[model samples]
Target: MNRFNIVYYTDPLCCWSWAFESTLRQLREYLKDDCEIRYCMGGMLASWNTYQDTLLMVTRPAQMGPVWMQVRQVTGAKLNERIWHFDPPASSYPACIAVKCMGRQSKNAEEEYLYRLRKAVMLEEKNIAKPEVLLQLAEALDKEAPGLFDLPLFKQQLTDETTINAFKADLNERKERNISRFPSLWISTQEDERKSLLITGNRPFEALQTLIHQF
Candidate 1:
């Protein structure tokens, strides 16, 4: 049997990840049975409020508008650039915590919750960074599975550190381990030897499926 440790690192607020969601979905559809997956956070937006006046927040999505179009051209996923004008810059940490919270609740539910989050923001124009909204999401997720917001676990479970040490460590380790690209795949041996091949950003499902089979 061939087993792979596939690490997916991305930011919730990242527009590229939004474009890549279909690829991510396709990657899992083909690889989940054959691989052990790990989801890691790479902090893309540190803070949203501090940039209340700066162009960093104001201009990022403006920049993303054309990028979304390009990504749509390539990936064929739906993204509404109107969100940039309608919603404020999300901190992405709260959304990240929500993901961790869902994962802590159910590994299976994590991706579903993530999908909901992306849909809420990217499609419906909902603000997912708010506790009320997250709580609502939590309620929806919890109805399907219980104790998701049991707090101490979500608080204590690497959510804080994933940004601080865990995130930095993962970045440094990726460099040391020589894994490049956002959604890169690093195949690992039982002895923990690593060989990586870049999957690149948001390609067709068939391309990723071939990569999974090649391993």
Candidate 2:
């Protein structure tokens, strides 16, 4: 059987993607060694250049609180909306760059780091967009995962220009795919230019199973 390659386009700050975590984990476990999964960080909030007033950004929590409450009702995921009431992140680019830098350690490390970041934002309501918060996440993961991350090396990679560029490349790929939504999954073979399956928005495990079964 030929292995499938899956490109997951997501943003750390995206609640919809966070809600699909369970489904994604189940799909990965079911596929096991038969699939290759790559996570691409799509920049959710590039910047606030268009919005001049800081208050305009500050009021976002009000807008997001109700939305997250509805998401929790649907996905059954715990999300702390208080983070928005307090100090909200200005952009998701920093978190995206941090995840890209973590990839330098190992693929597993990158995935682990991304998972932690998402949990911090969605559950713990941590401001993962900050550099200090990101470094703290690295330390916590190092202690929790044990030998999964190299702190010194990870910090070094964080400052490397390539890491930032890699994140920008992901954003460009999102544009190329004409992806406007979070939690988009593109399944294809290495030998094929066409995608075998493309799923957009939050999806259930059954949707994934149905697509893979067709192959």
Candidate 3:
């Protein structure tokens, strides 16, 4: 079978990306052995310090309520809105870096870590910005995941020179592409990587399915 490669650009803390999880699962099942989904962590929120300057602290979480409501209506994915106030993340960078670190182990580990990170933020409402939380999540997952992710190495890599550089590189790629949205999909065949399709924002599963075929 011909291999289909897709670069999925998303953030772990993105509400819309959380909603798109079901669509991604469906795609995995649909594509089976024919596709490779490569994850590109788009650092959506660099820090709360950035948000504090523009929006002030109080109004930030308030703004997300309606947006998450819309996500619920469209994607039928549940979110704990209290997370915005209960234990909000300062930055999505930590989670993104963690995912990239897991990728060093294997794609399977990377994919599992991505989902676990997403769940921690969206459903469990944990503060994934904290290193302890990320490590805890990784520890819990290591028992069940196919390969044992080296905890000490993962911790070191989180802030290592190479890991930070990779994060910067991906962030730069997103900026160059001018992708201002989460849950974006860039689809192409291995034979012609340049000939691709870009799907931005949240769309229904049927829409994604159609694009998968069209691509």
Candidate 4:
């Protein structure tokens, strides 16, 4: 059995990425031990002050509501678009940095923290850009899993230069790979180190399953 690696490039506040959660969960269960999934934060939105997405026509925060609604209608993912109107996030960089901090604890912690961030902004209408909100989520995770996470260490890492550098590395990786969209994947098999496939945007479970089989 050949093992595979999947580099998942995504942002915490991306609507399409949130919609693809179910598909990702199914793919994970189906693959089991055959694949290793690594996350790379794409820094989708650094700050609205200098942000202008011509494709999505999302120059402002309020324009994002219809985009989320469209994704919900198409993917049937439960999303609250009111966040854009109510407490919109100014940038996704803070949440992305928080995820890098969580990764210092463990891979599981990193993944769970990312999911919590997505759920907070997408479904719960919480502002993930705030450090206090991010810390509260970490505390909740600590309560849920007890000693799986070190609260003091996690808090320190949030502002540490090392964690911020790690996130900057992810941003640079995305740029080098020319990945301009969320929910992008770079898949490669152990048999060939130089060859890989890049799939962007949200894809169905069967499409991913078939792609894995081809490898």
Provide TM-scores for the models. Answer: 0.73, 0.91, 0.90, 0.97
Expressed as tens digits, the lDDT of each residue in 1-215 for candidate 3 is 44688889999888889888888888878888788888888998886556532332233655565667767886789987777766667788988888888888778888888888888877887889999999999889867763567777787787788888877888998999888788999888887888788899788878878876775
lDDT of each: 0.63, 0.84, 0.81, 0.92
| Pick by lDDT: 2 or 4, better one | 4
lDDT of 2 by residue, 1-215 (tens): 45789999998988889899899999989988988998899897776543222422323445666667778898898888778778777888899999999887789999999999999998998998899999999999999888998899888889688998899899999999888778999898656637477889897899788878887
The clash count of every prediction, one per candidate, is 0, 0, 0, 0
Question: Which residue pairs in candidate 1 have backbone atoms (N, alpha carbon, C) closer than 3 angstroms, thus clashing?
Answer: none
**Candidate 2 global TM-score:** 0.91
Looking at model 3, which ten-residue stretch has the lowest summed lDDT? 51-60
Give the higher-TM-score candidate: 1 or 2: 2
- RMSD values for the candidates in order, in angstroms, are 4.6, 3.3, 2.8, 0.9
Model 2, runs deviating above 4 Å: 49-59, 191-195
Query: Model 1 residue 136 lDDT?
Result: 73
Q: Which stretches of candidate 4 lie over 4 Å from their true place?
A: none
Q: List, residue by residue over 18-117, the lDDT tens digit for candidate 4.
A: 9999889998898789889999999999999999889989899999999999999998999999989989999999999999999988999999999999
User: Candidate 2's error at 168, in angstroms?
Assistant: 1.0
Score candidate 1 by TM-score against the native.
Answer: 0.73
lDDT of 2 at 211: 76
